[model samples]
Target: MRNDVVRLGRLSGERSGDMMHFLSSMRADRYIAGADILVDIAHVLMLDRQKINDRATTRQLLPALLRLHDKGIPEEVFDDRFEDVHAGIESLLIESLGVEAGGRMHMGRSRNDEVVTCIRIRLREDLIAQMTALLKVREVLLTLSENHTESTMPGFTHLQHAQPTTLAHHLLAYEQAFSRDFDRLKEAYARVNQSPLGAAAFASTGYPIDREFTATLLGFDGLVTNTMDAVATRDFALETLADLTIMMANASRLCEELIFWSTSFVKFVIFDDAFCSTSSIMPQKKNPDTAEIMRAKSGSVFGAFSGALVTVKGLPMSYNRDLQELTPNIWRGMDDAGESLRLLADMLASASFDTKRMSEEAGKGFSTATELADSLVRSCGIPFRTAHNIVGRAVQKGDLSLATLEKAAGEVGGGISLAGKGLTQKDIDRMLEVRYSLELRKAPGGPAPEAVIAALGERRKQHHHDAELTRKKQAKLAKAKEHLIAEARRLVA
Candidate 1:
């Protein structure tokens, strides 16, 4: 909108305002503005170290750059007058210091490399935050599991009760899924932390530049090496989106369960008032709005990932204007997933379980019939097939009493005698009791309280290990930032 601002040097004539607006990525560029500043500072420091820019030029540029960093980029530069934050920052530098000195700050880099470098920096920070949110949700799950080790419930298949399980075991299944999500994010961080700064416009610059020097200053794990790959590839973004999509899918599954559990017909869980809302038309409705939204958000994340895949699918090697479209997708996916993780943690922590109702439901639906069949095989010395037939008939007769068992045995056990064996009515009753059924299956990964407690201990240990990894990565980035600022100050002094 302002004619005073410098236009691209390659184009000499007046530019169309509508064309600039159409070409602009200014809306998404704000997210990477701070990272852009860091990239500039690191590039300038590398330039000074290589003696590409004279001492006088370095001193003049460093102080102004530091000032920009301290006070933040001028708010006016965000207009459609510029193509992106990269150009906007360079233009401001030129406006203040004139072309000769301020312009040299771009000595060995192009916006192609500069923008991607900024993206990686910003994305790595986001990945760390996402990992922290995941760990918090996992911790909540572990704590809930520990408290509910003895609380029994029906575990379902095809929406019908298939077995009796402890709440601890059920919660830990989701914990295992989220633990894998954390691992995926950690792997993606390694790829996102690589530097792409020195690959100017898809080729190495003729200038004597040390890519490694800038990489270290910017806290990149390593260089992106190939110039074309550095600028052209966004598979790192794709990988991260894939991980987020999978993570949200896991979250959505748990959210689906929470929604079902909160229903009046199920009544397995009661959400806190903070997470529920009353219907405007029906005051009696206490809807699980938060969980429902989180569940729906998984589809949004999927769409973002799908859109990113489509954007990158057919692009040829080297940079294209289409790459500009991917950044907003990354931001949208990350924000949705991060907020969902945090809110899910808070929601689960505040919820109350209907343990009595869960226990009652655990006893219905022939949930322990397998245990009864196993008891017949173990105590009566009957073959498992014969035992299964006897129990199937008992269940089919719609009663589990001693009289029903005797009739079922006569009808289906092929004349197999129940006389003089150690099996008795008391034994059959014990096998049908949910607690007794649980105790008999104390193998590792089982739903028995002892097994669930053992699993909880191991998961807690894993949580500690994962949390430490996240902290170390974050600390390394902080240390690099402090060192960068100190080095800039030293140059100015």
Candidate 2:
């Protein structure tokens, strides 16, 4: 009999006709058993209700499902037996208990509703975890931005030197990106927080299941409004994947910078030796492969996003097998995104910037042209076009030193004067100050140091608040799971 069971299980795929025979043959001696948590809840409700109250049926089937659940049949058996996890559990229950008793388990719901509910529950927890990791990355960026605000580096346009900006300013740009990402997640969370439990199959169930209560029990904000939409839509998945795609893309941009800055030619950043790789042949090679890998892996995430979109693109107004394939991609993308965020935070936190080198590099390539242009406008009453022409000429001469160029500017341009508006040489000097340049444009969203600092502080605070909220949500999820597990154990025990 053992030899027969082994042979039956190993039957080739060409024996497709024999697959059912294989399954039934293995179950000849031992009955297959499974359980659906929602079904159990429904059974209890049925027993409590006067119309469907059947204690004997509940007693017979509920305990059997619970017993099988305790006996530890592999989860894969459920997948192999029925169309889905929920059905597999029910089939197992029917096999263990009599068909009549098992028939009562599915009181008022379809797998359409149950499957969506289970995925939503699972994904809610996953999204919370992803958000927590994102917050950690944001915190690191914020701290780095604040600390490096004064550390000047060459800002670029078209991959060429454009101006001198604080390393803090550049870091804060990413901080801003992450802040928006966090906001996107908050918006996504609103949609994800809704429960879809009572929308059984494609339509609402007949059971008097209090959806609001189930939603509250599941820590959801409310029940999904429309039954068909609840089961058929994967918008939550799209929103999450979109946000993650954006995040991974942004992170990849940062990685590109890291890789460039760590290169021998630039050497603006020095990554930790631990995060570096070495060339097989080159004796002196210390490659920043960690950052490079991150930069490269972003494409994989985009592919995941594309795969999901294509899967759901032409599907009709109902659930389909195509949607089933989306789960693995979603899971993979989320895992990759979370890991990328974690690695990036660690890399950014420990990496060193060559401040002196950056400052030296900052003044080159005529990066201070805008500063000179502004000086001409504010001091000499020169029109912007005139000032711009004068500054461009000075830059063409390859002299970036403001003092030398200021003298040169005075010598040229018919010896322009700042007599009006009581503008003195000292005021001219003040206008030349980079901090002044940054601070003067302190509109609500300007990159002034003060503004950047304020934004950093606020973002840091919000990050903590968000993280705490996630923790509370996770705790609620755990408590709910505990309640469900306890209830299942009680019935079985």
Candidate 3:
């Protein structure tokens, strides 16, 4: 049995070493160690203010905690022999100040409330990091879109060319999807920022602790209000995991497209050498390995979310050990999604697009057939269904010539006359041209160059607005931390 486990003294028996290791959360607790220390300090300051603990006790405990906060949790604090980081820190304090003052440090709070509070603090920081990373990706998308508004490409439905569009338009589609993801994460942050510190093991503490004061000191927006709900629920973590999973799902889709675009057959994009790898045996292979790995790893993130959901599903409330299994999943999910976003942003910024090949491909695969039908509707005064039938028949005949259109018109146009309809060969040729096809569809959100450019301008404004919002959020957190540490120092002095 470890000395610290014996020192804990809640259980009287000699605990098995294997049991100690099995129940230990030291590895995952490292993530929250710093937050845990800040939480301790906040709780201590609150205790001192409420006169629950003497000023001498606060004087000794706050400095020890402030020193730990300054230098960081030591390597010894992560020793599995300690069962968890909370026990390890408490053991250190008991050793330093003797049990009288050190034991009193946990007066108004339980490890139940403390752990969740630390998780929220750390999770909010990570959420901001993810939001910032997502913004960088959005920035990259906007910059790429600005450059490629006129770079034509064949847009597909069912993997068949359906229309002529620009690379900018396709990239902006992803930007719009990811923009929703950012909004969700930002919304999740609001719920995650609430405090659970004074809940005290699922019920409010008897000590006259000021929950609001502790929440402010720890930079939380407010209390969780219901003490049992505070300790009992992990819906906040589940919500965050859901947000990350959705973002990663979007990322995987973009990666799938990038993988396809980088293929030798498609040749629409060439990723930078840094993001690609050559096959060891096949000398000619420059694989889209980064994108492929990102695509695969998205599954792991999804699995983490699934595992978290199942872990929380069957457990009776009020803080089960099963909840311990969920924290590592949140950490892993956030790390995977955040790293993927950062790498994707870098990969895209370094990539080169085959604009000429895209333009040439845009003109193939009967891509402008829709425009031909629209022209027939406009110039010949035919119903759209009749126009659609004429184009479909002409496409089946494998040509867009006047003879083919005239023949198809007789079969499918239902007596709609083509004679003196002003439908000349020049009109047919113009309708079949990719650039002319693109230009004619100038409605808002169309694939036309002008429409794409206008959309890009609006997206840039939105990005700037989001970026400013992120900056303000970051500044607020920073200011809170500074104030927290300064106040702790004041109490110590």
Candidate 4:
């Protein structure tokens, strides 16, 4: 009791001006918290099992962990006496309890396993948070795609107008990308869900530790079967970054299109100013700064991915100091992914498409040249090659006005039996009706109104199903967390 009072007083005194020092050494805190708790738990379990237990010694040892757990040592308390979090924790234990009681808990564990476990827990928590944010982004995208199901926009090939497509098709392209991201993360969970418990310092503990129980206690799905692999490999972190890199690469490309679309020249859409920004000197500029920044910072996630790869490269490791360098890099990439997805969701929610402008431009710039060529084949019985050549020439020539086009149609053949009984100038006019042309393309995957509506209906059903599944998974995770808190409280009680 006297020692407990003294140690608590010492901790309180060190916390006054040293709070900055402790907060800055955040990794050290994590290590201390992790190592000390594991050691204390092991000691308690061991002492309880001994046949001729030393009551006084057990009494003394219990305080080492209890004191540290209750009142952790401030960073200022250590100068040159400790080497790392492991040493710092043990050294504090010795200072609080006598060395005999403090030293017994170090029997079958190593700081290598301790530090790795801490990172694993941190990663699991972070991944769940990131996945939730990604789900929100996907939900917003789905809503936009449904709302714009029939809104026509010019589809491009080689940056030139090729055909007409609905805005819903464009939005669903991103939904598919995000859906794949979700699957990738879920796949990664199978590997990352394993625990490193009982892998003491690159080797299995000789002590009869319940590794499975501890793993379950930590909410891990299983234990790492090979003890050496548990401490040596950081492939889980690499896999996560690889997934983030691929997903962000796709997102960056989409943001590039958004940047292009929001421009006055294309005028496909206008982003709300709340999701955009103004330049310092340019008075009339509503810069797509949010989208631009998303495109730019997306590269930072890639950079962090490369940085972690380099950190782990060429290291034949049981464990090395270089592995510690990966913590910030892993977390930095995750931060970028989380924030980028949030920004994308907000932009999607607030942006408005200029359907009239998009639809108007959808038919101009010789966009109907394909329709004209098709008419030649279907009506004049001309070979497709000859039809393509004729339309291509007509498009290049300055005499391709609507009036000129009708006159030319008569010269080609006013009443050929190819398309029907009589192909006329009126048929050409009807073919040029943008809505009619689009509606006439009633094939399964075509941009016809019926197809678009059907696709929208299917996607909405999928979204509802996916959203319900996500809700169920979230509920399961919440229940697990509640169980952990209850069990931990029981252990203390």
- Show model 4 residue runs off by greater than 4 Å: 1-107, 375-383, 398-422, 441-445
Model 4, range 258-339, lDDT digits (tens) per residue? 9999988998889998988887999888999999999988899999899999999988968876777776688789889889
lDDT of 2 by residue, 270-354 (tens): 9998899898899899999988888877887888889988899999987775777676667778778878888988998899989
Q: State which candidate has the highest lDDT.
A: 1
What tens digits encode model 3's per-residue C-alpha lDDT throughout 60-147? 9999999999988778877777778998899889887888988899887888999999999999999999999999999999999999
Q: In candidate 2, how many Å is residue 486 off?
A: 4.0
TM-score of each: 0.97, 0.82, 0.98, 0.80
Residue pairs of candidate 4 with colliding backbone atoms: none
Clashes of each: 0, 3, 0, 0
User: For candidate 1, lDDT tens digit of each residue in 109-200?
Assistant: 88999999999999999999999999999999999999999999999999899889999999999999999999999999999999998999
lDDT of each: 0.91, 0.69, 0.90, 0.69
Worst lDDT run of 10 residues, candidate 4, spans 1-10
Q: After superposition, how far is residue 206 of candidate 1 from its true place, in Å?
A: 0.5
Shift of residue 360 alpha carbon in model 1, Å = 1.2
Per-residue lDDT value at 10 in model 2: 52
Off by over 4 Å in 2: 1-53, 56-83, 400-449, 487-493
Best by TM-score: 3
